[model samples]
Target: MPRRARKYAVRTTYATNAALALVLAGALTACTGSSGSDGGEDGKAGDSSASPTAAEPGKYRTLPKPCDVVSVGTLREMLPGAAAEDDGTAAPSAGASPYEGEPTATYDTDRRVGCRWKNATSLSTRHLNIDFERVVSYDPAVSDDEQAERLYAKKARKAGIPLDPDDTSPDADSEPDPGSEPDSGSKSSGSPKTDSSKKDGEKGSGHKGGTSPDGHTSPSGAPDASSSPEDDVTDSPSATPGEDLAPRSLDDLGDAAYIDDELHTADSGLHRDITLVFRTANVIATVEYEQWVTDKHRIPDSQELQERARELAAQLAEQFED
Candidate 1:
């Protein structure tokens, strides 16, 4: 071969070898990258294997299967005599006329009544007791109606009171007006009648002068004396305050119901129980968790578990109406 041609041939063979080596290197790198990505995806899916395929945003995230039992007990110790009197009357002991049995009540796993929980994510239960001795007595000389009106006026004044108009006309659809005059002139005429009869009926009858059984009343009759103002000022049955008996999961409770509340979780285990105590307000709730193990090498994530427990306790505390 010519000298120039031989040199060109040698250079071409070297260049071809270098290009082939580059292609092989790129192929090996692509395989490694693909393997790594697959491994990562598998690991993530495995970690979440216990999670439901689809769940509502705020619903139970992961509940224990087969259910675990949690016990709750509550007691209302009698307040001292002085404290009881301040509440209204002597604190009645349990088994007294109004209250029966021990002041304390208990509910075990078998006798659960108010306890409730989400099927998979949480188990919740609670109990409550009310110290009757601590109840305050309310006294008012006037009737309930008068008391109520006064209370209403007081509240209204505090909330920007408005003037009450003096319109005496019966509301539309009221009965015919009873003649107002007692025929005083006829009494001297010896018509065999006296004012006593009329007054007695007016005072003794349960019905108010202006108002009928259906709430229809003459606008002119003195505001029914039968409607005791005292009743109005006194606490209504619905207004009475006491601890509730419902056991609710943390997610289902609101913030106002509890005070000095806290939650904690264990550092390691396939199962964990969260204890929540509301000391000052006298409320307590417990939540238990069971982990489904997918791999022996994998351990429960402590940080994530604790965060979930806190969220549950906060939700339960918010349900109070104090």
Candidate 2:
């Protein structure tokens, strides 16, 4: 072979090898760059993971049966009329079962349940109802207790009871609308003209008919003692704060609580409804007691019924602690 041709072939081989080396280096650089970028992204993800931490779970996930929470003793006292026939008769009358509670219908027992009792005697008709709700928050941002607190706040407002001004719970995150704001100018459906428990906050059942202790609603500021519940000791507000038996927030019953009293005259007679609502952890409980007497001259005693309702509420609150 000629020396020039051999030299040319060797140079070509060297150039080809150099080109291959450059290509391998470029590929290696790309791989290293991609691996480094992927590692940086993974590190960033790990650093921000704690910022979106999930909210804590609620205290209670299951609710007890509503009918079972309230016992027969409460029913007996609340429904005294049921015992009226028992005293004279040797055997149980084939009448409405008074002590056997009627459970409210609901699709979900774990989430909500209620029991209602109604007893009618010749003198007065008594009604008792208990409701239990186990609140749940689908959003990961909120908890069950917080959701329950909000629900209780809403219930208080609907009943015309004011939210506690000093409530520091998460539900109190924003100031509640004033409950004193005149009710939508009209009474709610089937709701009669009621004297709010807050109505006598400063006066115990204060005079409603122009400083007169009668159950008349004097719209003209004129004293109309000739009301249906006239001359009754349980008339309107105008007394001392000690008798402020109107609808008001309760601080002692549970995590939060309130009571509502309403009096309205019906053809059967004048009836008074006393209701209590309380919250514990993630559960909300309600105790509503009603007394209806055929006599219009006498109204249900707020203090008496309120005391009983509060007692029952406290009992139910203790149950949720378990």
Candidate 3:
């Protein structure tokens, strides 16, 4: 019970109480942080909202140049005597020929591209246009290939070409036969003669048989029996002059392909328009070839136009692979 012993005891008790209070404060601060509160005891954790979503990536990150999609050799093949691209200048006209290749405008050099060529020969005039498109998908749920396929389907449908029109689709092949019509005059005015009719009556009926399917009537009621049957029977209906062009699917070109052909008759001559479209992976290519024949007496050949357009398509498609 001395004064010194009492003073020391009091100081030790105060120091112990202060140390216990500091430990309790430190434990509370850590608990608040681990509790997942917006503002921890330290108040240093700023806004803690969820992060923005990330975008999906496309298959092809780069596209080829549109102007150089086709080679100079192919361009020459498509348009004989056509000038080639020199540096940034177009080739000069040779002997007044119009078949020259020229690059078209491109809004985005990386995404879209186009080229054109034209020529006028003594026999006919030819023109060709090619376009290339690179597709990209911005959706997280869809892929680049899927997006390209969707666009391809839309283009194919817009072309109006029936898919697989050969055998399964009858609408393309089936047509009302112009020759199948029954002769009304023969049936109404003239009576059906018995097996043994008067020779004079038979001869007279044969001469008066009005008209054939082709509007050319013969002595016999039907087409000339001596002519080949194929001459009268057409495998497929031919395109009539001035008829709207219908799209037809083409095989062995690319993943998918089609062609649209239109025939026009003018005072100057007969002309034809042919369009070919093909898709490969993430790129879709289109080629447009138009022809004008100087001689109205001759009709423009469809096979020739189709073949040339297809060749251009194949050439353009090759660039996508690179």
Candidate 4:
């Protein structure tokens, strides 16, 4: 072969080899870069996987059957004079059974349940209502007890009952006595009439109906020595403080308990309402008992109704324990 031709071929071969080497190096760098970037991404994901994201579960998820929560014997004793249909008693017929209360309407039976009963007689009327609630925990950050506390606060507020149970009497400054305001006109009229009558008695005629100096018959006269003031006592209706009608806190009941008593006057008579609410764990139970009597001034025995309500509340709290 000619020398020049051989030299040119050798140069071309060298150039081709150098180009191939450069191409191979570039491909290797790209692979290394891709592998390194993938490794970095994988490392970031692995670090994040250590963090927890799941929430904690609640203790109670369901409530007891409202009607069955209270024993049958309790119902009979608590609701006196209740008719068969209203008391949950079944008829004597083949299918007839003792009274089992009717449940109230609710969006979800599992979360809440209630029952009511009522009966009326010619002399008096009676009614009973009960409710149950199941609490659930949805926050992973909060514990069941904490969630329950919050729920209890909400319920207490809605019921107008304080959490700590306000044992202290209402402040005089904050709440003015409703009966404190005086009637200026009544005072003025009463005093002048009394004074004038005394003056007239001292002056002349001792008769109670004697005319005053203005020639008007005296209506406010001193009573005769033979007559007693008992008639006045019998004729005037007295005003009472009605403290018995206030809601009071109870002790030795579940976590907390309260009783609210109200007196309602109607054409039938005076109705005494007693509402008892108790809490256990995450569940809250309420029982309302009411009765009407012919006596307008009669206040029902609170202890009796409280005992019955407490008995039922205890039974319901036991269900949570189970």
- Residue-wise C-alpha lDDT for candidate 2, range 126-232, written one tens digit per residue: 66778776677655666667767876777777676878677544543253323122222112211222443334332223223121112333221221122222112
Candidate 4, poorest ten consecutive residues by summed lDDT: 227-236
- Full-model lDDT for every candidate: 0.26, 0.62, 0.50, 0.52
Residues 179-298, candidate 4, lDDT per residue (tens digit)?
A: 222212111111112222222221110212222212233211221122211111111123222454346566666677776554444433444455677767666667776654444454
Please count the clashing residue pairs in each candidate, in the order shown.
37, 13, 3, 6
TM-score of 2: 0.69
State in Å the error of residue 171, model 1.
68
Off by over 4 Å in 4: 1-53, 82-89, 92-98, 143-145, 165-251, 266-268
- Cα lDDT of candidate 4 equals 0.52
lDDT of 1 by residue, 36-136 (tens): 99999999998788554442121212212111112111111111111111222334453121112222222221111122221111111111112100001
Ranked by lDDT, top first:
2, 4, 3, 1
Of the two candidates 2 and 4, the one with more favorable TM-score, higher being better, is: 2
Please give the lDDT score at residue 258 for candidate 2. 83
TM-scores of all candidate predictions against the true structure? 0.21, 0.69, 0.53, 0.56
Please report the candidate that would top TM-score against the real structure. Answer: 2
Worst 10 residues of 1 by lDDT: 128-137
lDDT of 4 at 37: 100
RMSD (Cα, Å) of model 4? 18.2
